[model samples]
Target: MLAWTGGGVTLLGLVMLLVLAASRGWFSPVARLVAGAVLGLALLGLAVWLHRKESARAGAVAVAGTGVAALYLVVASGTAQYHYLPAAVGLVLGLVVAAGGLGLADHWRSPALAIGAVVGAGLLMPVVTEGWGPLLAALTVVLEIVAGIVALRRGWPWLLVVGAAWAVLYASLAAGVAGSAELWPAGAAAAAVLVVGCALALYALVTSSTNAPAYGVLASAAVPMLVMGGRLDGWRGAAVAGGAAVVMLGVALVPRLDRPVRIVALTVGAVALLEATGLLFSGDVAVAVIVGEGIGFAVAAALLRSRPTLLFAAGFGVMGVLGALALPLPPGVLAGYPASPFTRGGLLQTGPLVTGLIVAVLTVGLAVAMLVALARTGLLGSGDGRAAMWVVTGLVGLYGLTGFVVGLALLVSPDRGGFVAGHAVVTVLWTVLALVLLARGIRNTPLRVAGLVLVAAAVAKLILFDLVSLDGLARVGAFLGAGLVLLFAGVRYARLVSEAETATGPATPPTGVAAPAGGAEQAAGDDGRGTWGPPDART
Candidate 1:
């Protein structure tokens, strides 16, 4: 701490010398620049000599860092402030100083010096350029390449993060305040950073820890993405995000790539795809596309047998369902098209009808894929996680089934009658599906609970939605159909439960532990085991 403090204090004094000297006319511009350079060289010489003695090695590195900062100040002031050196000369000198400082830091194993070098240079650029986008962006590119190469060689991934943060700050300002012509340079800078960071990620990917390099790769991608996303969020922005998605996916898919990096890439790619979908499509069409993509990701997860992949699949699938409810109904549907679906035209001519059908199919697929992924990854735990999944999948599947039937009914009937009939079909479908799930659930408690939930939802919809949405025979048909289905499902599930209980009766009392009340009692099972209580009570 003392060493660093001394270095910082000395660096500040050098700045004061230049400022105070000019104000007092104590030296010419050349004299002031030469004097600063001389002081910086003296510090470097002192650091080298001190490094020979183990006791002073730490202080030596700190002083070397101060000397690096001193050189940067002199070069920057000479070029931009006093006009002593040409801009190119100043930039070349700056890069040289940065390179030398980083090399020393790496060689000395001094992260403190490395951080100071990258941070000091990054902070000074904005001040010198006064937020000029092109220059700042260009310098950002050069600085990243220099700093990143040196840092990665020493397994220093965090420096890249520090460097990228500055790049992003510059890129953001450029994207927001600078002209369009200047934005591309910032984009280029981001691309450069990502490319180099990827190299770091790929290096020893099989053995090296995944977190450090993965963050570098992600941050490298974030610069242009967040900046461009905030400002250029239409097709142009979509294009950029889509391009980034493709790049990251390529990085992720590389053979033998780190798992964390691959998962990160896939996750970011999923977001990018949805972002593009929103930019390109609206309402149900957008929801359908998002759901479709999510389904595809789910299947990929299953094929890969990856837990992280499945988790993302579950998230995106939920997002689709939520978005469906949050967003308004599609074009024609909003205008009461379902009541008389085609007063003007046919199914092909009705945009919302077409979109509704598409969305319905994808949404249903999303549910199925979620379960398949969970099963693939052995993630269907017998706990709340499994139960929540079942419930969510049931709702998603119900939404899809209802949409599909409604769309089909509207297509065939194209009147209020068809709309009511479509809903009637929906109710029937829900009841039948619930019965299947319940039968399957007899052995899986969570599945049974999900089936019961569906039954409740179907009953609610019949009462709340169908009672008002339909009329005349449509209402009667919906009610009678659902009621009969419910009655049949109830009888069938009851019988199935009885059969299951009879097939697996309670175990015989342990040896020397006599049956309750009397040593011998009447038994119900053919195997001589008794089952005289409610199924749950016996268990």
Candidate 2:
């Protein structure tokens, strides 16, 4: 502790010497730079000699690390403040300091020293560049390379975390965090950084011994948005996103890749695809592409049983729901929020009529596909809450459906009459959809639960909103439509139960429970899925 504290204080004092010299005009800038460099070298020489003895090693390494930081900072000050060296020359000198520090740390096997050198150099970059410009962007790329090498080398997961944190921060700034940065340049540099991250991630996966690969893989997967996110509103943004998506997709396609790596790649690629599509195209065409991507991803998730892919599919599906009703947002079909879906409006826009319908249908389809995938693996009702994923999915699908219905009705009539009429239609639609889900019976427990929940919501709306809000024929139609649908659903359910029993046998209840005349109908609990137990319990 004392050694480290002394090293830190010594570095601070060296910084003060430069400050005092500049304030007092004690020497010329060249003399000041030369003085600092000579002192740093003296400390380095002293530390090398002391490192030869076992007793002085800790303090020796500490002094060496502080000297390296001092030299690097001096070079930065000379280039950025004093104008004593060209930017390129100062940066090259900085790298030499970094290399020397790393070689010493490697010889000493000191992870802390290596971290100090890389981080010390990197942490000084923004100050040297005075923040936000082409120079900083270039510097960021160089820093990313340094960080990547540190991450790829043995011993120092924190180094990667620190590097990634800086990468994300600069990428955000470059993207226009304070709106001061040149967006394209920053975004371009961000792309390079993401590429570096991906390569490191892949290397970690192929060669890491501990947690190095996991951190690298996950960071690579997440960095694309930050890197390209600032300029996603432009063609340059599109290029970065498109290239990133392609790279991730290619990585995912590599045979025998680690499962986590493949999953991360697929997830990031799906996002990049959405961003790229939105960036390259406009309006209905983009929505159409997104719809297709959602469906394809969902179906592929079902086939491949990839939960992460399915999660993205789920996101794409919900983005549709948000788009349909993002009312305040102006023109274009989700020309806004598929890539960033949290921008949903208050159920007002429901988008263009055709676009809403298309997206709503896709949302529902994705939900069904998700359920099908979970079913094959018996994931639902397993106490993992996986069933809720599809339930929320289905609910959003219905939300899009309702928005479009009202939006279309308003489009047709543009008055209170249209509004009432839309609600009437939605009431009937909800009832019918619930019945359809219920009709799937014991084989689909999750759907059955969703059906019951939907029916309850429909009943609440019918009593609370429609009963008071609708007038004359609109109110009559809601009540009448729902009643008839309920009747048909009841008869169909009874018939299906009879057939199920006749095809199988008199339904058997668990031990200690007597079979009633109603048999399986009563035994199956409220969901009519026979007590929806965990998967292994059934067999």
Candidate 3:
């Protein structure tokens, strides 16, 4: 009873502390460090107490508490800036507490606890101060370095790596280090620090026991880098590109994500969006940004290519778009696109076409490589609906590109029938993929809704593509096929929605663990690998 009470109080304390912190305007990184430390302490105490009295419930309570604490810290860090001392202090204190807590509490010495402590500490530094501030700032830097060493020596999963990087960056800044953002410093001190941080980040990404820790470290590292690159402009862009390239290479050296590769994919997608929107630059620096993005995307796409490869592919796509946007052209044309070279009224007015064709070929080649990688993972046949969706979208993109090329060719020949044929083929393929997607949606409620919307859109597209010109039996056949597909999909969607509600009804737990059809080959490898398993057997 005492253990249960302690666990309950600790859990409540964590929620209240964060709520209070946010309410009090301490939503910065410093607050996160402090909050994480406090939460880790509370969880440690609860885990210890529970183990002594509530043995059967201990694992559940401990895992839940630890996860909650880690998640809260991740959220806080993401929202907060890195230059706040309070957050850094929280990080250091939390690391110490976690290290001590895990070491002292028999029940809490599990690898998950140790890893959380290290990763939590590494994330806290930027939360505290951005390598500059007052006297306490210097101490924070030194302490983080020391803490990282301790954590590393004690086998704290990714601690030594992430911690070391954070510490060296702080130490360099404290030692009056300065470098133009556009370039990796050629100076001894700055270069050393850069190299060390790169090494550490790569080490964590490649050697960490689990993707969770690697994700946190890499995600956090990417933030400051892009921000710094954005501010510095020239060499910074180059450095950022180089760093990202290194990370992409390192990702190939690591094991695949045991869980769904969703997080990495989302991160890639977000970065791609940022790059595509020109958020990567300010002035003439935009030129360098474009060049770097082009190279980066081409290189990244050529590298990472698997189920986990989604992140790099997305990032590359963004870079490709941004680079295209950066190409020099007339000041007028499409709203977002630069004018075609033809508008300049020169003999080489078709320069964009030639350049675009070259870029297209390169991009297509990389996309094909990505497809091959995904195929190797067997993700295409895995029946993992999400993978299926990704594959379908990829195929659509390929067909669309092919259609564009064919359309361009037909424009010169003025062959209306050929144009119709291209559209018809694409429309047919899309209809089939759409039906499959809708079927897959039966198990995924959100996808099911999206599928309905897509089906409607596809029907409209087919009407425009086929019905308008078809005058005979072909028109009837097209309408009949499309109508049957839509009707069947509608009926299937309705049934799935009803099933979803029932499946999520009171007595049933959410089906969050829908592993792909291969029976979780990756998770099986995680057994004894010091990773947190499903909620029931956390460590």
Candidate 4:
């Protein structure tokens, strides 16, 4: 009883001091170290106390709980290699304590006590092996793999988190050692884990209703898999092909999701596109991916707005093809590799000019469609909170900016003087769009700020690229003129909005624009025309 009482008091003091140290920032590091030590010792004492007074079964639980804490303190203190002897002693003792704790774990998912022990032990592996780095490195990977697999099977969250951390640690070590004699074995181990882990992760997502956890597991496994495989040309080559197929399939499945999920799933699918195309590292693939994303977004927007699906199909389909054709096709399909079609061969690159023109036409079409949609819908806010203007801004902003870049490059018109003129026109168009976004009665403040900032970026890009070649006088004059124009326009726009708000009264509920009441009843009558009613009557 006395031992138990003393242990509880010590544990409470350590917990209190640790909290106080963190909150007050009073000798924080030292306080933390002392707290860790005291906590470990208190846990140890509690274990001993339990062994004496409790039934053997309860004693086992107590011992396991205490040992895990002690393990952390032991490994943490021995972080530096110069203290190798002390580190080894601490590591060995901690492992012994952890082994006893693992034996006491009553269930597979008993809060991951055994796995935690191994993780604490894994940290000390680097400190122990000064000479045989590769061997030690492989051991760490194996430990991480085993831990990750166990975590998935048992549904232990921390085990998965720790496993990812270890993978990163080992991957960094492997990167430096990859060119050396140790490369083949390390690569093989990584490949094995990648294939197995990824398969498990995909199975979890497809088979289980839970998605977030599945994704977390898959992402952790996939990143290292890509990194390790990328270094081996043969494996990297095969994996890249496989990844492309998966991404394509994922894209096709996006439309099947419910409306909200469709948005989220498509966004994730876009990431797969980036990954697949990025690894291919060809100019054509990059351009295709960017163009595809723009087209896909446009189609999704049309669908959301309840336009005829056929209209989207026809519009985006033609736009996608034209966007692709405008880029000067490399001398051959392979020419698309290394460099994109937008890049100029000389000051007079024909491909970029053609591509730019095609892009410009498509962008103008999209802008028109969007404007019509907005005008028809009016400046009214969404009655449904499920949708918001900011979401629209974000989606459209992504597509518009991407299209803008391609359009400008195309406008450069492979001719010498045309390049400068094209760039200037693009900058002016960008500034105009930015002004529209800022001046429009946007409900979302962040979206408004983003639009203004994007405009500023366009102005900066213009000065940096188009005017850099000009003489001192021309450059200064252009800068001053542009700055003054922006400032005056911004001020005028603000004043107008301010005045409009005052005259119209502060923003009000959408009750004024309610639909007609009993329209259905009137339409059913002999008169085909329905009688309109006041907004209040509609409700």
Q: Report the C-alpha lDDT of model 1 over 1-539, residue by residue, as the tens digit.
A: 89878877776676666676777888787888888889888888888899889998988888887787777777766776677777677768877877887888888888877787677667655654445464565455556666767666776767766766666566556656656775676566555545655555455244366446446556355555645654665777777667766777666555465677787777667666666666667776677777777787788788888777677777778777776655423324422443323344434336656666777777788888888887787766567566666566767777777777877787787666677788888888888888998999999877788789889989998988888868899889989999999999999999999898779874556576445443234433344576443333443
Runs of candidate 3 with Cα error greater than 4 angstroms are: 1-147, 156-194, 197-227, 251-305, 314-349, 359-367, 381-391, 394-539
Q: Write the per-residue lDDT of candidate 4 for residues 129-246, one digit (tens) a residue.
A: 3432334444445444555555566665466556555654565456435674766655554544445445555544544545455455445444443454455454354464346335
- The TM-score that candidate 3 achieves is 0.39
Candidate 3 residue lDDT tens string, 133-232: 2222233333334444444445464554445455445433433334354123212233333344444444544455453453543444344344433544
Error of 4 at 28 (Å): 44
Error of 4 at 190 (Å): 4.6
lDDT of 2 by residue, 1-539 (tens): 78777877776676666666787988787887788799889988988999999999888877787777778778767776677788678757766776676667777877777666556555655654456554455554555566557656755667666656555566656555434345555656666667767776677666754665355545454463535553456676677777778888778766567777777788778777777877776765566566667777677667767666666776776565455445221223222222112123423343454455565565556666766766654565626777666667676667656755765675576456777888899999999998988887546667677778888998898999899878999999999999899889878878876887788897566687555544555545565567534433434
Q: Indicate the worst ten consecutive residues by lDDT in candidate 4.
A: 330-339
lDDT preference between candidates 1 and 4, better one: 1
Index of the highest-lDDT prediction: 1
Off by over 4 Å in 2: 1-6, 116-144, 147-151, 159-396, 402-439, 442-495, 506-539
Clashes of each: 0, 3, 17, 2
lDDT value, residue 115 of candidate 4: 51
Question: Highest TM-score, which number?
Answer: 1
Q: Which stretches of candidate 1 lie over 4 Å from their true place?
A: 1-42, 53-59, 72-96, 155-161, 198-221, 247-285, 328-349, 379-382, 435-539
**By TM-score, how accurate is candidate 4?**
0.39
Error of 3 at 204 (Å): 7.2
| Reference-based TM-score of each model | 0.73, 0.63, 0.39, 0.39
Overall lDDT per candidate, in order of appearance: 0.70, 0.67, 0.45, 0.47
How does model 1 fare in lDDT?
Answer: 0.70
